[model samples]
Target: MSHLHIRPKEAGADKRIINITPESANWQFVGFEVVMLEADDTLVVNTQNTELCAVIISGVADVTTQEQLFSNIGHRASAFDGIAPYAVYAPPKQELTINALTSLEVALCRAPAKGLYPVKLITPQDCVTMTRGSGTNLRHIRNIMMDNVDAERLLITEVITPSGHWSSYPPHKHDTDAIPQESALEETYYHKLNPKQGFAFQRVYTDDRSIDETISVEHNSVVTVPKGYHPVGTPHGYELYYLNVMAGPKREWIFHNDPDHAWIVNP
Candidate 1:
């Protein structure tokens, strides 16, 4: 098992498939988890010293925090349904409760914070949907919680890659704390395939090849990138959807493209 590739845990009553803590990864900044809930089930998130973003990836749920109640926060049944998801962000020292109105799949993204923001619901309309690249490099992106949002240190997004296409293309890295040039952020990719049985591929590597490996990613798999230009690819028939959670010393996203592949973006 490559350090970068992660499979979910065995099914439990709670169905929290993937759980990645910063301590578990030996990387500071990003902590992520995904859970599947049955209708009427409930989950409680205690935010201690970190802020959280609970993304209602699919199905309906009522997400409530001390400061807000985001009721019936989802609609699509699957991540690949072409619908931007509903998410809720809550600050530190609070508890966010999620009660499923229908079967649900939610992602919990966490990062260190100073309690600077209140709980807020991020509607689909608030997300920016855009198409990037052309040809095989083409992909769709939904900015769930990006720079435009007011968060102390979390940048979240979702991407849908068509079958046989590439995403996070032109391989980019943000591992150097160069401010306007590049920001060091640890990232986690939670992936899902349309058919649920198909697989995708992701490569994580640094410029020097010191940390290079290509991973075969199965449905619900997670790939963590601590420092590298990571890119993803889906096979000919399986469309891919992934939720990305990023956080580090800086909250902004400023990545430097791999010099060798820089032309793909420039040309």
Candidate 2:
């Protein structure tokens, strides 16, 4: 199976640009898509068997469900603006209508649902932003829906790697179900570059080097991690941003870092 999945930006398409399901990526639990809507446009979303988290990349939108309506729910101009994003979670079997208040760009992160959870709107105030690593390896991490959140199996977050730096450093893997040490989770990285022309590199590999690949990722690229330690790097002049969606047997994140680079995290 191909470990690296790349979906380029498709212009003049309907609203959905990148659509990734478990069958499409050959993964078990993770699914993701990016949608761009013009002003006043509307789209109906149904979470049939999967629970979805809709993240506002830019512009304003009113997301209405049978239980609640989230109006004027975005404030950032772009993902690179370093501002907290607006997001909403819809449980499985729920139907939602997204009305574009402005030209909107949104990301739909999904996973199979085992139980129905309450619909929650995760605003900027609900996000936890922190800086990770030190010096050149420093990067910004935004925890949108973490394990602490009341969710079934999805963990969503965003990472921003400054120019000339690395995010997801110390290459980590969560492919084994080793209890507190590591939990088996399938993950997907949906990436966006600062200048749209800029690019980034991602390496997914295993200890035996049996599963290994170094991918060149551009704007609107989606990278899937079936089982490996994955690391990402941005070039000298360009910044990199990516949204991570993960789900598996457990609802927590327990990972093991590459021993060769684990010292960096300690030292």
Candidate 3:
């Protein structure tokens, strides 16, 4: 709808956005955008009590975390005591510098496990679980040794869909603990455009033919999962990127889609 939305409570409310700041650092319950640099510049960051997983969305920078120095282009970094201290140096000529943080300036954004969960940079070599069932080339980042942690409540997956094809097309929902056969944990969707200048469509609502809601999604947009089946659509001219976050009481994240459309899994 607007630039962004945030669903603070898990009720049936719409999404909202919160401005990013270093002093008020907290986990974003839905998600937040962190602007690292305006142009070729340097940024010194100070974290409070929150751990941060900063993913380099665009542009290049020389990042220094603790005693380790990560330099050059196309790199991501994670910091446990991100609330402690970190520094970044942007490259010459690159205009925009943005980094997506796991938890930022929010109250409910979840954090990594209690044990030693190392911060890792995902690479093409680390892409695992290439599945064909989802009608796209879906690779995941959770199975890695560095990404696996006990306090990590969210699982991030990346999907590349062909133009005119579907990714999360079947429309599914996981809103209860009814049974493993039909129930699942709640989830959140964060989208990114492949062309870096395109948009897609998404649908979320009850299956009983009541309470239907459709959202026109673009890059840096977010959708919420309350208690209904949701399906994502990618247009013929554009590809898509979506990050899913899930949590529940059973300590396991699972789901169940609409029954009639569930047959799409076979076709």
Candidate 4:
């Protein structure tokens, strides 16, 4: 199966821009969708049997759930704004109605859940924004809902790589649960380019080169990593942004980096 899945802007139908489920991606866990809503428009979302993280990529929206209501929960004009975006989490069986106060773009990340966690509205202050790597490998990461967060099996975050830099550098893989070394997890990347016409390159491969692919991704592209070491690079003159969704048997973010290039992280 192809690891790279692209969903172009014009491919959206009925406000659903991108949709990926366990059955669609052929993964046991993790699913995602990108939704666009016009001003004053509303959409009802049911978590059903999965836990979901709804991230507001752009514009303001009011999210109403059975327990509480979040009014005007977003403010970033675009994904490239360098501002921390707002996100909401809902556990299984919860229903949420979202009313767009302006033209909005929301990313829904889902994963199978066995317990019902409380609904949470993750504001900008709640996010942990950090810089990773160094020099040419520098990138910004926004941990929206991490392991410390109250969730059953989902981890959500976003990363921004400047031009000519690497984001998921050193080629990391977490397809096994080798405690203190790595944890098995399924992941997906939903990408967006600054100029829209620009593109980036991503490589998904295994240590033995059994499964390897170098994919060229553009705006609104989605890439799934079932099991492999994945790394991405942004070309000069273009910035790259990707929303990352991950899920697995364990609620941890441990990973093992490629031994060959592991020195890059230290040197």
**Most TM-score-accurate candidate:** 1
TM-score of each model, in listed order: 0.98, 0.96, 0.61, 0.96
Which is superior by lDDT, 1 or 2? 1
Runs of candidate 3 exceeding 4 Å displacement = 1-31, 34-39, 42-51, 73-116, 129-131, 134-151, 178-186, 194-197, 208-211, 248-251
Alpha-carbon lDDT of model 3? 0.46
- lDDT per model, in order? 0.92, 0.89, 0.46, 0.89
Candidate 2, 44-106: lDDT as tens digits: 899889889999988999999989998899998889998879999988988989999888999
Q: Give the true-structure RMSD of model 3.
A: 9.8
Each model's backbone clash number: 0, 0, 10, 0
Native-referenced Cα lDDT, model 1: 0.92
What is the TM-score of candidate 4?
Answer: 0.96
Candidate 4 residue lDDT tens string, 1-267: 354665645534357878888998887899898899999989999999998899999999999988999998999999999888999998889998999999999998999997567899999989989999789999999989985477988988899999999988899999998877899999999999999899999999998889899999889889889888999999999999999999999889899999999988766
Give the per-residue lDDT of model 3 (tens digit) for 1-267.
422233223212111232222223322322233343434455444322333444444445555555445655343332111111122212112222222223221112232333233443444345343445443423222221124333344344445555566666576776667775554555556666767577777777786756477788776566666558777777877777665555444445456767788777755
**Residue pairs in candidate 3 whose N, alpha carbon or C atoms collide under 3 angstroms:** 5-15, 5-16, 6-15, 6-16, 26-105, 27-103, 47-83, 48-83, 113-151, 164-236
The runs of at least 3 residues in candidate 4 whose Cα sits more than 4 Å from the true structure, single-residue gaps closed, are 1-3, 9-13
Question: Residue 118 lDDT in model 3?
Answer: 41
Instruction: Tell me the tens digit of each residue's lDDT in model 1 across 141-251.
Output: 999999657899999999999999999988999999999999999999999998999999999999889999999999999999999999999999999999999999978
